[model samples]
Target: MSSVKKVLEIQRETIPYLYEFKDSKLTPFSSSIEEYKGQKQAYVVYSFNKPETEQGSGSRLLYTRIYPNESAVRTTGDFNTELGEKKENFTLNEIKWSVYEINGTPNIHLKGEKDGIVYEIVTQEVSLREVKELLATFISN
Candidate 1:
């Protein structure tokens, strides 16, 4: 089964809401639902530059993760607490979001929660504005 179909199946069975890229330029190539410490997480990976690989590469990839519940999402309120107020926070339609840099790394993490489920979008190449646009797209969904 294709990644998109897998995501749809997972969404239909468990998640109430999920985010996806609607742009023609982004192509979803991989997806899966994982469990760790009894928590469920659904994720889809979209690639912008190429397709199909023996080993996946993170460059130019857009990754989105969906957690089944608030407690399942560890970074839910990290910006206000663990992050020590050094992150960028924003909101849209009652959904609160935060973008924080991974110390000593070039990657940025953007996370948010809605209706008890948490959603996250992470990439190494996309700009903050582009990330926000992606977040807005997710919110609209």
Candidate 2:
């Protein structure tokens, strides 16, 4: 029973597109509900580490964010040139996602709206293939 699970349970009905990793190797680091201009948003961070023998043996972080309603979602660009290059754009299961390569490192940023709730996901040192695999596990409930 972690804070992430608790938040997910409480927000299960509120967030139509909420997702969590099913892999045991990935564990939630922290989760919380915060307010932005009177609107509440929830976010969870998960951390994973590969074995030292593996090529990418180090700590990696993945982030998930839920905007409970249309107003809470950021409508404008973040103006983050630091995100590096935008590789491509595609839609998956109604979620429009943008793939970006940050400093030649593997990463992803996915944001979309479903059932009026806006959902976003960001990954650090995580490959696009891996992110898609995780998304495939999500049950729309």
Candidate 3:
């Protein structure tokens, strides 16, 4: 049996958020956890893997929303290089974004599988503040 490297990273600031279960096998090219408008958000990636194309996740299709405060959610039957491509309207106040989008950066990745399979529990939003507040709760518990 093989053990996967899972590390939970906490971004410190006025509002903090945590990134849990990050893969260790992959090497990051540019990675950092910082604060955005009083919200702690992370911009992380590996030279070997990224949020979109790290493992076996295949395909990113584009779509648009027809509502205010609404965005497109990327759906994956399983997680790998990507959770999927999820675009949000930001106006919805219901559109989720990060755990995917780190900082002001966008992720582009190749798709596949690793050690059977891996999945990410994603919660996204337009505001880093909202993302921070949300994940802060995800970890404190």
Query: What does each candidate score in C-alpha RMSD?
Result: 5.0, 4.8, 15.0
After TM-score superposition, the amount by which residue 1's alpha carbon in candidate 1 deviates from its true location, in angstroms, is 5.6
Error of 1 at 126 (Å): 1.5
| Residue-level lDDT tens digits of model 1 in 84-141 | 2336888965667888775655556777777777777666576677666655555434
Q: Predicted candidate 2: what Cα RMSD to the true structure?
A: 4.8
TM, every model: 0.68, 0.67, 0.26
- Residue-level lDDT of model 3, residues 26-133, one tens digit each, is 333333433334333333332222356345322221111111112222343322334344433222122233334433334422211122221123222124443334
Q: Could you tally the backbone clashes for each prediction? A: 0, 0, 27
> Clash number for model 1?
0
lDDT of 3 at 38: 39
> Which runs of model 1 end up more than 4 angstroms from their true locations?
1-4, 35-40, 49-58, 70-85, 139-141
What overall lDDT goes with each candidate model? 0.64, 0.65, 0.28
Ranking by TM-score: 1, 2, 3
Cα displacement (Å) at residue 127, model 3: 28
lDDT of 1 at 53: 64
